[model samples]
Target: MVEGYAVGIDLGTTNSAIAAVTGDEPEIIPNSDGDRTTPSVVMIDENDETVVGQPAANQAVSKAARTVQHIKRHMGDDDYAVEIDDEQYRPEQVSALILSRLLADAEAYLGRDVDSAVITVPAYFGDAERQATRSAGEIAGIDVEHVMTEPTAACLAYGLQETGDADTSESHEKRHVFVYDLGGGTFDATLVEIDLEHNHIEVKNTDGNRRLGGEDWTQRIVDHLAEIAKEEGDVEIAGDPEQEQRLYDAAVRAKHDLSSREQTEVTVPYLGPNYNLETTLTRETLQELTADLLDQTIDEVDELFERSEHAIEEVDEVLLIGGATRMAQVQETVESYFGMEPLRSINPDEAVALGAATQAELMSASGDTTADDVLPGEEEDLLLVDVTPQPIGIELHDGDFAPVVEQDEKVPISRSDDRFTTVMDDQTGVRFPIYQGQAEEAEDNTKLGEMVLSGIPKAPAGEPTLEINFEVQSDGTLEASATHFESGESVDTTIESGVRLSEKEIEQMREALPTLKDRAVAGAEQKEA
Candidate 1:
């Protein structure tokens, strides 16, 4: 049976969008309330109703505490959270709300259930964040046809231009391309080689910064204005909640305007009945503030270029993804870095989702009913070769981390390393901290979770040969299994700390959304925040 209405979703840190291929053409479906792009904001109503998109983002300023945005960045980490009226909410639950809203919006437009969808994520996102995204999709009732890399997905959208060509055979047999993606909230550079022979796309080398993006640049501009406000009057705008919102709102406007204009002045609204204060900021000043951030992105992009083994000019296309690419400064920086005009053909907002939809079409057409699709030449046995975005390892005897799985290792793969017992007559459960990133020390990488292996049989320190095996599935989920070489005893489990909040946490946040919302619901809120 043909998969009905394959959908592609770009579940972004700042904004999210859903699109689908219409028969042979791609089309973005309007959200339930009749809008094209949906804000990646989630809010709760006074009646315990969960809301998403602009509505939730609107609350971000007022509720400031409850409405969660950029939760995508905190995926896999346990420390990040949103507390409302003294109750704590997990990032997973927050992301789940966003997914739910997307589903409701898509279904509302199509008049059908959207069970299967291909979601796009940052190529740099580790096992934890990728897994979190999957769980969010699951909770939102998505079948999660596949989780395609954002850059790879963008390539799918761009590669369509070469389709239906007479020379497609030569182009399909192992073509090389570089995907440089500088988006809002994250940056990813990947080397992708398309093998039409196997009808597969492989990511060669990946490099990026999780905390760097357009928002980081935008916030830096906001900081400059705050400084200007301080020096002009030794006054604090952020300290005053009312003035802070207006100032930020104006700053965003100025940032967008500067994308085309050389300089734009921002005037903030005056607070209090006296209405005595006014502030101005310029585009040049904004660039000055984010110079360092821009440099960092370029450095990483250069590193990826070196690893991809392709020169800057050799890049087939420089596809820009994310809303932040609208800034002229970002566009200019990219042009200078690659020595070419970046392709703005793909809607920074819709490109990822379109690529995602195209992947779903491929997955469905492959004739595999399950999430894992049909392999070439064989029905329902696709071989996916994915790699660890960052090197994963544990700390050794000294401060340095020992690589269990080297960076960018292939999937459905495993390796075992022999380890000596840490202590004499140890009977306690062995806890191994799993981390992802490119740091010489384990502390440098993001600690995803702890894997605990129990009942070691109380062996002498020097007597046991512990064989630890690290395995990654086709879906990019990781699991570590350790066995006592002597007895062949083994243990396996997930690495998540109980940090995944209980159902009670979800209930309270949803319950409080409305009360907090009504107090601040003075304007039109986006249907999906």
Candidate 2:
């Protein structure tokens, strides 16, 4: 019976938590540490003992080199990792430790093993990032059934069980909704439908930068404080390790304080003693420091709205998700951007987790206990249709980029384009970089992956016929089938480069799991032996 349980998890950059609808409403399972959200910080001390959660954060101020923070940004990166004590830790591994803690806490509370869960990720997360998140679940002994979009999950939480008169029987008309998620480390903006019937909640479009979010705002505030420390306190402690720690913490607290009250007075004694400087940071200061993030979010929202056929006021709701939205300035900025006041009744930090739980409940009730309970790729009638987040294509003659499938092209879309040989008797492999973003040159866009069409037989210059077909289904995953149209041969391969962990690195991570899964397995083996 416990194996039938489905857990909902929100693995954030700053913290992580889990919940499930085993009882009435979804409830967050408290960890043995007496904390619901464990800090997402990790440290590798000189002793090589892995330090996690609050203990890791404690050393962050002093041992910056040995600790990793804001790692959620590099979730799917195959190249990025934390190098401490001459060892590297992948983003998935760092996140796995966080998941390990969540899994242990959920099992400890659920009275039996929690075999499956629906984990939430940023809507703008790329294929690699999404896959990396699923990989973390795998390492944690959890069968990830679905990786729910942050916005979709937020919408479910916003209206689940509490669908008000705005979206009830009499008022169950299809309406558009926007989700703006500004978490500690990243932002995601999504366009969805709220009709309960057709498409249930159709996802129209999504856009956001994985690198911009609340942590960047905090860093900006810290930069300003450092400048003030030098100017006002006559302190020249640029490389002073102790001074750096003091400044980072001071700035973070200042940002948190400015979210509610009008102004916050911060003291930086490390700058000097009673040389003690008290700086008053106002909401205006925060807005000024975080202007770029605000502008970027607004630009993304504006683009979505611009592409819509519906009027501005017709949108049913503007839902805000993520702890950063607690900032009054953030709400005001969103309100101004959308021309409508957004709802805040739901706790941003808990909304996504609660939605994940609701989905888990739906899946369990349906007798679907596997991960990916939520159908992926394009579906019809009851299916939620999603478009390709990027443009897929190959280069043409004269170095022109020919788009095979436009970005946001509707789900279940397929098209074939021809690529001719540019050089005479070219009988080799084809090399092309997969691109995302609207840019004319490959250098300006985000490289998603690479494609190589090989085994082309030598032919007269510009004589080889290459047919490339791109098919992007509802789930937003991309697959391509290319033919030597000349030879009528094709290969269907899903190419996504992910941050890889060597066996040695993976062995180190296993040793760091909150619960020793291998040891437990070995013990069972010994008992059988």
Candidate 3:
């Protein structure tokens, strides 16, 4: 049996945070380093021991090849793996190490074991991505009570912070909020409706590019500096991982400094003997270099509103929910497009984790209750209604797509399609290739996995009727089943995702946690010594 209270985790790409609900309030749990946020970086030292967080991040320049950063972007990718010391680690495995570090700190702070948590992810993530995140939690020895969206979590924190002590019986103003989340490695534009009076929050629509974020902007700066280095110092920074990492660190510092100052100097030292590349980056130059990237986020916001029933004018408040939204260019563009300044009462970097903690509290109180079943009685009682980020369906005979669950559809839902029939006589099985996308052609969309319903009675073509059902949980996990009309035979589905780890592998990683934890502690001690 698990012990201790459930906590909330914001497993970010660049930085991760953990929070726990204390009495009626949620508080961010600082790591062992006494920091609210920990860098989502991991490195393997010369001793072949694992090191995580700030120490790992600090050594990236010297151990570039052994360092793993921004592993969140590769979650659920089949071909993506980080190789260190000739050993390959899956994305979830790397993510688990980070989660382990966060939980370890939380356990030490609370003086108790933490076995359950609610993790947040990008609002636009699909089933595979959500599954990978859950797998990471399992591997870290935590029961992932729920996998909530980042935008929704932000709204929860905002709403609770504003009305936590207010009377629930009184009527409050209803507001439509637009959440523009530009994080380290992913972006999401979500339109949410917050009814504090009714204690309800619903996600109306969401869209984003998972591959685009602040890192892309940083890369633009890195490229500019690299070009200058080669031209002036005749030093080759490109294709050299160590030099590239050094420049990346410098570029990130310059990016943050430029956020507040008009200009900041960036210097990459020891690139070569008696050579140091120095450059001055101005705020205007940073804006100019990353204008297109900023525009891409605005484009996603426009697309989000286009697909939503509420327009920009209908949005009563706009909330910026990620650290990347601190950029002046991002603020200017968002203000210009929405004609309103975004609300900044809540801390952007900490909102998601705080909200996740609030969610864990609610889930703990209302055991096994679904989101829709949550009612407003106390000030803390609120319903969070989320939706499927993408359409999921099966491939038809002509290679066209047939959607069973459309995009933006409210989740914790089940839908069935009985239009499928046997194409060949005496067919004992029917293979259903599941896909997630809005493409008209099956091949154009992302194939999530496949489920074959076997044991169908032999019959002539078109004689056997099959009813395929799809059920999407609140956490965005998908399960399927097929029922034969005449025989009353049913076969449940188990989607074999190419990018996800198997149950056996997850258990193996879970079993190895103690050994890894010891190594991490030893590595940290070694670094300090």
Per-model C-alpha lDDT, please?
0.68, 0.71, 0.84
TM-score of each: 0.84, 0.85, 0.90
Clashing pairs in 3: none
Q: Could you arrange the candidates by lDDT from highest to lowest?
A: 3, 2, 1
Can you tell me which runs of candidate 3 are displaced by over 4 Å?
1-3, 164-171, 365-380, 397-400, 418-428, 439-445, 454-467, 483-490, 494-503, 512-529
TM-score head-to-head 1 vs 2, winner: 2
Alpha-carbon shift of residue 129 in model 3 (angstroms): 0.8
lDDT of 1 at 487: 67
TM-score of 1: 0.84
Residue-pair clashes per candidate: 13, 8, 0
Q: Write the per-residue lDDT of candidate 2 for residues 354-425, one digit (tens) a residue.
A: 888867766664443322222221222333455555566655444556678876566678888775453656
Q: Give the runs in model 2 whose Cα sits over 4 Å from its true position.
A: 161-167, 240-242, 272-275, 364-383, 394-402, 419-421, 426-429, 437-439, 443-451, 454-458, 473-477, 496-529
Residue by residue across 372-467, what tens digits does model 3's lDDT show? 232233444567899988899999878999999888999789999999998999998888899987789988877888888788899999999999
Best-fitting candidate, scored by TM-score: 3
Error of 3 at 60 (Å): 0.6
Worst lDDT run of 10 residues, candidate 3, spans 369-378
